[model samples]
Target: MPEASPWDGISVPAHTDYTVRQVPGPTAVPCFWGRDRSGACLFILDLDGDHTDQYRKNTTTINGIDVDLRGEAGRQRLVLTLEEQIDRDLFGGLCSTLIAALGNASDAPTSLAVALAHIRRWKTFLSGRAAHHLTPEQVRGLFAELVFLEEMLDRGGTAPAAVQAWLGPEMSHQDFIFGNTAVEIKSLSGTERSTVRISSEDQLESLNDNLFLRVYRLSDLPDAAGARSLNDQVVRIQARLAAPEQIESFDRKLVLHRYAPLPEYDAPLLVVSAVRTFRVAGDNFPRLARSGLPEGVARVAYDIRIEALAPFECDNDLVFGGGNG
Candidate 1:
């Protein structure tokens, strides 16, 4: 527990939110998600208001334990900044606990591992629902917002284009169509912050039509993962496989589009199957496409380079955790 704000004393910082009396025992901090605060930590993770009065009257429990934001009946009423700082400290402690428990630097306990797995599962729920986009600076903010979100829940979301990993203008059915197995490419950039949504009938149609190609950040060398192109990725993967010590850096572009690398037959190879309607499996849920496949369905495989899937411009706000406070 933390000591309440000392407003009764002297100095005060402008951005401070509130103060609360220190309780005897320690508490676990909840993971934080969405906030209009951008990268600022001046406010509580999910709290939206500055109702000092509320702190003065209410008793609430974070997780399950009761917390009296207000100082005991006679003590100085709690301030908003006090509560904000306490929550911040809690969030930090939780991060360290999660990382260490996960064996970031050393071996952690099994219980912690299990707890982290659960958190990951829960985070997936949040990532699936994030309709909003994040900028690079916002994405890598020191708070590790997404990482925190993951610990809080138990699942995740994509950081599309952080490295300029966009849907390239080239796709090939020949690569995706493999004796009953389909593979579609789903890539991301090395430094992008926005998440790409894999929804919609057509999008789902493509995913259903072929196995998804989810190429993300992978590095075999010190600075190699920072490379930004399919060519770079290929080169790095090869170097690592051939001679790991020979490579210096490994920064490559992310790709998750449909593809196949067949060396036996290179002459006008088929990439796409004739099936117009198909099923779609994704990083999240699975579904079947409603519309027909692309034109000229006779080819077993078609080299349909990605022209453009489409842009998402939904007007709705992405409410995190169903906006639960």
Candidate 2:
């Protein structure tokens, strides 16, 4: 049988805004689980004192959920209400996970911080879900980044340092940065045209640091013997990480990238057929730099043919040499 949910047996009372039962766990702060008048799920954190000044200013909208501070003064409660459109099972998982996070906190402020961080993670996860799965394009892109990340780890760096170098999830200009060197990653189907799209003017602009673009040509073949899925790569990386802190950091970055391991990511297996590295410095390289763009022209995106980058092509060692090259 499946495990029981915290929301089980919780019911909303008639004529009341909510009918709540204290969350059953050893949490640092008092928490409750309930249902609103319309039977929507709710998670409330009862604050010991008025924390409105700290929390109120940070309030922002989250999809499929509502966050608010209710009551006044000594009775103020931080409420999280699940919208009717959201899946109950998912919300239940979120509530339980959040409570577990709060259990590690030692005070109300810490609990509030944990709560906000948890909700922000969910916000990223929910916004990226399409039928509860990432799109094929997203999968391919993420797979490429993982491939590069795994290579970095294999180069003998500490797991924490290598994972921390991944800045793609944070929307940084470069996908991976190590000291004075930066690398941008791209992916494309092996059967498609040999071209990569540069999303912005700053992507190839190395400034004073060295920069390289790494492209992975992947074949999506599920029946092949050497095929692997996105989940396969994620688990492979996880197995190599022995430190709990590094593992947690890696998992958090994955969530921030709008990825959740679902059955769908288990198939339509992908295999990297070839990888090409290109040096992005020198005036001969083909790219649009921010310094060269018109005064108001920003968010520029353009494509660069792989063949045109031949002159600027370099070996993988020069790019992934741990910033020494």
Candidate 3:
């Protein structure tokens, strides 16, 4: 049996045109969580009036998600049916976000306005596919940056500034730079979790800025609790950005990172348990500096063995001096 929905107990007057509900979970959005009659995790929203024409004009495929419009006159419903081939975590997050923002509200005009705005944004993302194809390398790089942002939030950093300043693909070397500190994030997967890939010698050559290396050992565990996808992390970070300008900046950064508001990132689930940080300064840190490398090697990239670099390991908090990271 499906779990009770969060909107199950919400009551409405008999004369009301429609009401909203959701499948029970700790989700931040109002949406059904269980399988549909056809046995798929589904999301359904009921609008008060007919939206047939609107849905017909706006219907478009996004990352294999099928948007369907149903219901009779005087009451219309929008159903976002999920496909089995896409990443389930991202799909679920999309449903949760849309449902929570558009449904379970008494004000019809306000709900419709918000829904239209979101739809326009989605359309724009779909149209920009040619310009922003999310590559595997970009996904991994962005994932590292996201994990760092999550860590910063956990450490009580100012969210608006921290999230806005996350320079993932924007900067060539450092993933994030705040004040005089530059953080290089490397995410590694596979059974060994043994190597960190350095993109270029210049990445670790920033001598003037305080440097730190954040290593995330991530793996895909189908049943792991608290695992979050790139999209999931994005949502969590957006909640912290209270200022409009900060939120806009974060959105722009997402585009630069090739992270469209789509449900097919194929993004690895973050292993919150396997996060580690190390101070990359001093002689103990193992790296190839630009000045030390051979004159012929310009854009040198190499993998450093994790086991060999254990001597310089430090607590996660130590890199940020125990305050906001």
Candidate 4:
């Protein structure tokens, strides 16, 4: 016989205060269908209310999703509502993201934070604003972040601190920042890792500071059995954040990256073959800098040949794995 669906053989009990029905389809949590004060159908995801003080301040609305935190510690629930006209698949995708973020936990405050993050992403997506597409550059950048995260975790760094290093915005000259050190990552596809694009004069302009460039040479695998997606890496990182506040902070960072809660990254299987780290110091490290330009030259970007940069290439241990110390 075929496997039974999660929504199969469901029953609703007779209740006096409110009517509750099981949400349809597969889900990580047992969501319930119910009516809100407006008598509109709302899907409820229950959470432990242990630390609900932060969210109790106000109702935050991003896009169309309303993050309604209800009740105290023992009876906390996150109520989500949408128009009946919305597509079912999109709604289900949003729920899946919530489930992934909640990670089978009943803790209220922490779960609430993550749920809010997921909702924000979905709100952007469902609002019909997101591109629903991950460019090759974006995918490469995400892979680099994941690699950085893996390396940091392997070396016994705290998840909260490591996650804070992921500076994903376009404004940040570097991809990561920990303490006084900044790391700029460059990823190239295919075997021939020829050159890397430096986005601005400041990207490599930190002459006296602890700036590092991490390069990754990647290729796409066809039908690789053990391959993992971006979502998989995200789950791995999220698991390492032991504290509730840490997990919540991680989610916030992900939001800043403009990463919406999608079912999964639809990109190809990215495989990294070579990883190299270079300390961006000394005169031998050839590149453009603010001091090099005469004047009025800004937003300057150029490509650097990898072959000539051999002198600056150093062991990955120098940057990660506690070699920097």
TM-score order of candidates, best first? 4, 2, 3, 1
Per-residue lDDT of 159 in model 1: 24
lDDT of each: 0.26, 0.80, 0.62, 0.68
Best by TM-score: 4
After TM-score superposition, what is the CA distance of residue 28 in candidate 2 from its true location, in Å?
26
Give a tens-digit lDDT track for model 1, residues 73-185.
33322112223433454443433333222221111122222223323322322233322333332222211211222222232322221111122312332123322434333
Q: Candidate 2 or 3, higher lDDT?
A: 2
Q: Report the lDDT tens digits of candidate 4 across residue range 6-125.
A: 323333334432356765544444567555444444567766444366665423565545557666767666777655566445555676566666773445555565666666566556
RMSD of each: 21.4, 7.4, 9.0, 4.2
lDDT of 2 by residue, 117-169 (tens): 56766676677652366778789999999999999888887888999999888
Arrange candidates by lDDT, highest first: which order?
2, 4, 3, 1
lDDT of 1: 0.26
In order of appearance, the predictions have TM-scores of 0.20, 0.63, 0.61, 0.82
lDDT tens digits, residues 236-275, model 3? 6665655434555666676555565555653566555587
In candidate 2, the residue pairs with backbone N, CA or C atoms under 3 Å apart (3 or more residues apart, or in different chains) clash, namely none
Q: After superposition, how far is residue 129 of candidate 1 from its true place, in Å?
A: 15
Tell me the lDDT of candidate 2. Answer: 0.80
